[model samples]
Target: MRSRPKEPRVPPDRRETVRHEIVSLLTGESMTAREISGQVGIGEKEVLEHLGHIRTALRSRLVVTPPACLECGFSFRKRERLGKPGRCPVCRSERIVDPSYTID
Candidate 1:
């Protein structure tokens, strides 16, 4: 009887790098910081930090859909940061939509 070759196995702890994983996820669809955090099992703040670095490091465009105020319909187009703004300047409403990110 001929013996079959053993297949190499990857360790359970071995996983794709966080940034790479994030890139893959973003490639499929746009996601908010909170959504990315939930998918990657990381804090939302950390996700934003990673996104900041990815924005600079990635050759492909990293597009940011800025958050908008739900109440006043104000868009945060000029905002620099990735995180959601505290309040809307037009209406002073705290109800705001989260910014989404995508790689194009």
Candidate 2:
């Protein structure tokens, strides 16, 4: 039987660049951390870490789209920093699209 080839490991710097690109794409629309991870070909936790750096780079330029609850239509406006919300205050729905951004 033929063995599958191993995928090349992405360098840390390249991973950061990928994260930056993903953040740029995410500026127009909100996306989950999982989605960003998939796009960047990295782990969700890694994506979150990248987000922290991206947020710092963006600083006051950060533009959060505000996550809306799919079930209850609850919009998260003045909640806190970026990350998955525990639950919707209105209907307690876990489904949410956290805001992300990039430098213009």
Candidate 3:
């Protein structure tokens, strides 16, 4: 069996990535992962994944407003995940507001 040749790695500066575009979109206005997905033409889950990296890359610039339960007025201020909560712990309601992100 013959071994296949390896592909060349892209240089960091030459790679055209979406992280910059994502940062630009998040500069002033706040948006949910769904909203970002729509704008960037990616899935919501992918947006959340990008956000995880962005949080570290941008440091304090990326601000995440925590999700809140609409039914019970419970705030998920301490929650760390980027995605919306499945259900409210306090009232067991699924009507939870999505966490919004913005760049400061």
lDDT over C-alpha atoms for residue 95 of model 2: 84
lDDT per residue as tens, model 2, 8-53 = 9876556346655776767766667777787777887777777777
lDDT of 3 by residue, 1-104 (tens): 99899999774452347777788889999999888889887789888888999999987789999999988899999988889999999999999999999999
- Residues 1-104 of candidate 1: C-alpha lDDT, one tens digit per residue: 99999999764453898888888899959999989999887789999999988998985388999999999799999988989999999999999999999998
Worst 10 residues of 1 by lDDT: 9-18
Off by over 4 Å in 1: 1-14
Candidate 2 RMSD to the correct structure: 4.4
Q: What is the lDDT of residue 12 in candidate 3?
A: 41
Per-candidate clash tally: 0, 0, 0
Those runs of model 3 whose alpha carbons end farther than 4 Å from true positions after fitting are 1-16
Best by TM-score: 1
The models' CA-based lDDT, in order, is: 0.89, 0.71, 0.88
> How much does each candidate deviate from the true structure in C-alpha RMSD?
9.6, 4.4, 5.5
Q: Sort the candidates on TM-score, descending order.
A: 1, 3, 2
- Tell me how far the alpha carbon of residue 23 in candidate 3 is from the true structure, in angstroms, after superposition: 0.4
* Model 3 quality (TM-score): 0.83
